[model samples]
Target: MTSSIGVAVIGAGMAGKAHAAAFRAASTVYSPVLPEIRLVAIGDVYAPLGQEAAKRFGFERHESDWKAIAAADDIDVVSVVVANSLHREIVEGLLAAGKHVLCEKPLSDTIEDARAMADAAREAEARGTVARIGFSYLRAPGIAFMRQLIDDGRIGDVFHFSAHYWTDYGCRPDVPISWRYQGPAGSGALGDVGSHLSYIAEHLCGGVQEVSGGRFHTSITERPKPIGQVVGHSRGNVSTEMSPVTNDDYATFNAKFERCVGSIEVSRVAAGHPNSLSIEVFGSKGAARWSQTNPSQVEVMLHDELGDLAGYRTVPLGPAHPHYAGGWAMDAPGVGIGQNDLFVHQARAFLEEVAGLPEAESLPRCKSFDDGVHNMEFLAAVAESAAQGGATVQVPANAAGTTNTVGTNTQEVAR
Candidate 1:
């Protein structure tokens, strides 16, 4: 009904800036044109950070309080990028105000809060508002293309999925403690990055049925207490005082899907590797592997290849890929894309759905709140298994008694 949608991003930290920049770029990508997106404001409790983000990202203004954003009539959509413990309060308030929301990942600090937020989303949906979770890595062209191939039976009956996400952000023992290091056991690296792995594993394969062989380790047992606010992974000012880390710095687990098994490893204390995530899926017919280090290509082996030529071939993403045709600036092979571009694609998708465009006219719909809840359940299962000393644990069934599958919208894939 509206010709233009007003947007605001709360929490002007690292991910918050990404959301703001994404909205600024959303309208420029893809065809069939999205409704005008107004960069209304940037909200963050830290006035300086919010003001800086607003100016840099072209927002009209900055607000120090998130409640002001919820009450503003000009804003129609908001991206909640605050701390996990703050998600329920901020999201529920925005939903009550009839604003569509795209929340950052892991849903909430706990499954209980995630479920409550989902209930709020359901109520808000009845009023024509939307709520979605941000799983930006899923927008990677190679990852999306891999899902398409599996769906089309390119790799028949996936038997094994192996994935590992490693980052050196917390490798130093001197890194100050922030919310990232403060949570229940299994919350550190597992909840931070492992959430992405769990969702991606399910997206390519199927819903996870159970998990076992869960292990968690904290290499840096304690860190200096930050004297002031810490942003993202940055270690701002810190006192000589130290605080005990209550979560794991490293976690590994095994998952059982409907028809396949998976292994996941994640760590924030990894050295040398900075933001390295790789996945290899083996199927009855062949295998495929992709890595974040090489985001623009996938290496695949298929049964169709003859004996002498049978091996993995590199497939560079191009106009022929799932989201590359009109989703990027160059829109051509080897032109390449990166992590920030994924945020652009994700932003465009969220705006399309918020515009109420038909399925045929929109990009893939963002993952629903129910899907977010299912993701939380998967994380909880892994945590439970870790607590039980690597004993097998069943993933809780969805309230709808159905597998949680992300909508690929392969119809958008160019042949």
Candidate 2:
């Protein structure tokens, strides 16, 4: 017999829609050893958005206020997909209410808030509740395959990692600005898209110890103010006056990890790339590369072969991969996986973890809020280095103002 878990989502935008879809998909596609998820409610500040999301996503109820869902006794799990500014309040509230949470990335607008969220997660763990950060990119099958290769010592003695996440959405001068453009700090392209790359790097490489150098550039210092609501990359009519784009349009940094030196770069103004996150790792024995633009394959180079024959080779996604079974068949042609599919795999992992089934123990970790805080520290260090004229900045061994932070130990993840 199957059990049912009550789930709620707090947001109605792109990420919220994805979470809702994933919850529904988790029940149908992946055979997670968890109670089936029943999407209970979807909440947004806008009643129409919340109501429409409820109808479209098959939620049993709609709420114009997120606080309602947080207090709902029926909700066993909640996905906090709201703005970064709201993460701390909502996540802490939900956790304090004893609800499991899957928070969207960039855990909070400030390191202080992120630290608090992590602490709350630890507290939740003490109570047998789970708190996960959404680093959905890690759910990609090709990336998972690459991680396995690295763990198996196929890429022995990892020494280098280079990555960049670039998008053209903010390239045009007329692009309107919003809360995403203004923040306490480190909230620009670096915190927005770069955070994903940073976490994935730490996930694949190791903990970042310091940032040797950093630089930032804001090409469009000012942007049109939107006349109305703005969604993911959506353009809106603007008022006559323009607002300053205080955040970095692009950023680059050199990082020292526990076992490797890595390069990090991110831009919202890149001309051609859209959601293009490219990462490569080099080791004493071999190297591997994966790009999000073409999410289905990984390129690898093995130096163990003769120098004349050694070169990068592409490996396409198939049934043998981590998540192929969830959406694609062994015979599916040409990478049929969709971006939304990653969230499904992510949701499945989160639910399985909540179930505590012996089988769930092997799944790739649903990154905890602790990991989110760790990555936020790295991002904070990079921003500080840039602010200090590109000088090296040591990443704090512990999150400041808080004694709580997750250890940098490598937790086992399902392949």
Candidate 3:
């Protein structure tokens, strides 16, 4: 087994907290495979929160500046959980500093930034450093299995795919504006939550070559506090007043894939639908469905006219499955894994990378920096296409070069 390594976290809010839990949980799950991991550092712009997180998450140190963590001597890995605008810089800097980085999605605020992140990853790879994207859904047990099934032809010749991720988070107008409402807010739903659909599109269906899409941003502005104090220790609740909601509330796109045609939707304004994320794959011989809310079970639709009636069957998945967490075995189904487990499961993909011989693991189940760059390119192309009245736009040859941010400012998608 590889020796234990030091890890650092670079955000103090919700995601930072989650990664801390996952880092600690990884030890139990990765026992015989991965060596011990020491969460050596935690960083946040808010210094007190960083200190508090260090204590709560058992980090060896805390700093207000992420650069301090990046420049630290003992750091081996960094999890970039900061805001969208900060993603590119932190990821690039961390990787440049010789630390493996797991950056939260969209890679950057713009395609340009995403490309920079991807380029940084490529450079890091050449220098033997590891980097991964933060698309957490790719770690879903059922989704992973589904990918294998599709690869093995369990679903013969996929011709179509329909994926939708809907949440009710944006339905409340009273919900004050956050960073998500501004210019290219960290990938929007397209990059924020929707990248999962796009990633699976490439992973499960195929890479999209062309897209004709339309986007929606119902709340053009928000009502966050008209003014708030930025005083230290009393950061006013900027989430309390009014601000223009500039991001899209939803986005729908039609894509031309290598072997399939599909529709993708990502929305945060789907009223009454709180936190529902599902993907459906239809093939010539069979189909399968995975729901984030029902992560423990995957619905497999097999049409064997020569056998049973054509219907989708529910399959219970648990520890019996390969790559499952330790001590988890589904006796008779119904036992479900929550959002927390997905993080642990996702971390396993990294362990595989850390253990594999060089170049053995090209891509991970979670979004890779390359994947983030690719998704941003696709989104940029789609927005461009939509802005031009839904014309088909060719995807870039590489994810590292997108100079246009608003040449395609068609919609602000719910993230």
In order of appearance, the predictions have TM-scores of 0.97, 0.90, 0.85
Ten-residue stretch with the least lDDT total in model 2: 402-411
Using TM-score as the measure, the top candidate is 1
TM-score of 1: 0.97
Error of 3 at 195 (Å): 1.3
Best by lDDT: 1
Off by over 4 Å in 1: 400-407, 410-415
Per-residue lDDT tens digits of candidate 2, residues 343-362?
Answer: 98788778877877554343
lDDT of 3 by residue, 290-349 (tens): 888788888898777456566888888865443443423332345677888767655655
Candidate 2 residue pairs that clash: 363-414, 364-414
The segments of candidate 2 whose C-alpha lies over 4 angstroms from its true place after superposition are 306-309, 325-334, 359-362, 397-415
Candidate 3, 63: how far from true, in Å?
Answer: 1.2
Per-residue lDDT of model 1, residues 156-200, tens digit only: 988899999999999998789989999998779999999999988
Q: In what order do the candidates fall by TM-score, top score first? A: 1, 2, 3
RMSD of each: 1.6, 3.7, 7.3
